[model samples]
Target: MSKYILPVSVFGTVAGCAVLLKQYVTGGRCPSKATIHGKTVVITGANTGIGKETAEALAKRGGRIIMGCRDMEKCQAAAKEIRGKTLNSNVDAFHLDLASIKSIREFAERIKQEEKRVDILINNAGVMRCPAWKTEDGFDMQFGVNHLGHFLLTNLLLEKLKESAPSRVINVASLAHIIGKIDFEDLNWEKKKFDTKQAYCQSKLANVLFTRELAKRLQGKLRWLLH
Candidate 1:
């Protein structure tokens, strides 16, 4: 390599490292909402992506996990994988198809019957850039699974979380949420053209709104917002 090219590459690498260091020191998050160690954490869509990775991470830190996914077999596989990787052997599987209200209700009922408390509930499931579709209840697919299902699930689990005390409810929202607005009347996409990006963004916005509303209603020694 030429001397000039070598110097330029060195400069770029140093600058990138410096920027990352600055962000780490000044802009990164602090783990402050609530501790998850030994706590019961229920994460939806725990079979893949960030959800699965997060479950593994929490398991390493000693959190008891319930992997909620659409497919029970997939959830079981994820739980097995997480168990193989972490100190937590308490991980197990459960069913949660976010598109179905009946499924959500059934899952909630089963959880209520079996578990008396839930210490951490991470609403990490989401559908992105999907074609327009409606759930059985006739709500738009993105909004139905990504927002309303979690909406009802969280509400159903509220008493347990509150009773557990100092619990955390983390809702993962995307930057897409910034550009979206809820058309309450047109939620089903009845009169409008279907756009994948719009549907995703609108649904993500609803997640944020629901999180804020829930925090407002249940703060003082009971709930926390872990974004």
Candidate 2:
């Protein structure tokens, strides 16, 4: 037992640090018991990961969820699963390809025309550290998908969002923004060699900045959260 003491102690210390780090990073559970019955919610990239999970939670709360994804098949599957889990059939799947500006416009147009009200919009779609690729409009993929796409979509839907006052917009930003810097001069990386990691960080920074400016413009009209 004496010979094994050092190794056991080191392992225990590492485990303890990991637990603490996770708790710190995850923050804490939301304490609100608010339910959003009769509310309409739009979530981008809701077919997988955090976006899917968010849709499920909102569905449970009796919200009408619109899942916007590039792949209709995956989105439909996710919508069905969420409906089954939450026993709420208000979940609908819609196509939203953030890589294309035209697609974004069309999605926004469809939402405005069909949806009676837009109570909550969650901007959750993103690409991370992808190889150098440009969007259909020649914009950098990360910036176009993560920031500009959502930016345009949100702006287009502003009227509907305001029509349904006391609405909310949630942006799922990354902690990587802490070290991110925007290169206004080379926003699309046209002049410099592409750096995937830096591009991702810059897009995340743009997300935060865009959210801030939007919140200021909306003022007391709507609630917004960036995380």
Candidate 3:
């Protein structure tokens, strides 16, 4: 019994340490308690994962959340859940298939016509290590959905964003961008054998580069953040 106790105590200590390490590495949680009461936030791929969690967080902060997702059913369900949990009736879901340029354009147009302001745009939709598939516009699936889609959507909504002024555009990128290399000659991956992992990295790198260039262009007009 005495020997067992020591082993059990050691195991508990290791487990506790692991939890603390993970918390530190993941950056715990948002420190600011500031609420976005009247702000409007649009998040892509808000049906699940980080996107859904982000929508819920902003909703709890009193922001009007618009979830754009490829899956309408899932998006609607997520919106309902967020509204219920946060008691924010302003939460809504809209169809946004990032794989298709036409869909992106239509969604942007609707937002411009219907919404009064665009306070924040979160480009959180992304495909990681997907098959060697092509998007509706005949581009690499990962690249198209992860970068180009958000690029076009952001540009289309630029006028509304500028009109709203003091607005923000958050591009969610991964550290994988460090290893990413853009093959400018074959942007569509048509020439070389497709590597899904490399494709994803390239897309992430594109997100980082795009955000940097956009920040320089928008300068004082709009704020940009890369995560």
Candidate 4:
């Protein structure tokens, strides 16, 4: 009985530690009771993964959610699912392809012309270690899609964001940036071999830098949401 007791206790302790570790890794839930009754939120790549989950959470809070994705069908389906789950009818989908500068511009233009205000702009879309490819504008795939696209989109929407003062810009950077170093001389990898891992890291690092610089520029006018 003593032997069995020791083994059981050890197993229970291990299980408890595993649970705690998982919670720590995934982080905790939002503690804010803030509801977005009339706020408008634009989330890129909201059709799936983290972006989709974020949209659902915001929708549950009663915010007007605009899902920007390359695939309209998927975006609409995701929006419908979110609406059904959250009971928020303001959830909708729009077209935005981060791989193309033209598409980014068009999306921003539509938002500026149609939407009265931009409450939150979430740059959640990104690509990870993928085969070397260039964007429509001939930039590295990871950098182009992850950093440059959002940079241009944010800049284009700056006026509208200012008009909707106290707005928030959220850039979803990755832990990979901790080891990233931006190569100014070979940003596009034209002078060296393409390394997918390094490319992803560089893009994430750009996100961090962009957020820091933009925050400085925004000052008291707008808020930069950091995770």
* After superposition, candidate 2 runs with Cα above 4 Å error: none
Clashing pairs in 2: none
| lDDT for 127 (candidate 1) | 85
Give the per-residue lDDT of model 4 (tens digit) for 1-227: 78799899999999999999978866877799889898999999999999999999999999999999999999999999999999999998999999999999999999999999999999999999998999999999999999999999999999999998889999999889998889999999999999999999999999999999999988999999755
Superposed on all Cα atoms, the candidates' RMSDs to the truth, in angstroms, are: 3.3, 1.1, 2.2, 2.2
Residue-by-residue lDDT tens digits, candidate 1, 1-227: 58799899999999999999988744565455554665888999999998998888888777788889998888898899889978578888899999999999998888888986798888988888887788889988999999999999998998888888878788888878889989987887888998889999999999888888777877685565635
Of candidates 4 and 2, the better by TM-score: 2
Clashing pairs in 4: none
Whole-model lDDT, model 3: 0.95
Off by over 4 Å in 3: 1-21
What are the Cα lDDT values of the candidates? 0.85, 0.95, 0.95, 0.94
Superposition TM-score, candidate 4 onto the true structure: 0.92
Q: What is the per-residue lDDT of model 2 for residues 1-227, given as tens digits with 9 covering 90 to 100?
A: 89999999999999999999988897767677789999999999999999999999989999999999999999999999999999999999999999999999999999999999999999999999999899999999999999999999999999999999899999989999988999999989999999999999999999999999989988999998897
Ranking by lDDT: 3, 2, 4, 1
Error of 2 at 67 (Å): 0.3
Residue pairs with backbone overlap in model 3: none
Pairs in steric clash, model 1: none
- Model 1 ranges off by over 4 Å: 1-37
- In order, how many clashes per candidate? 0, 0, 0, 0
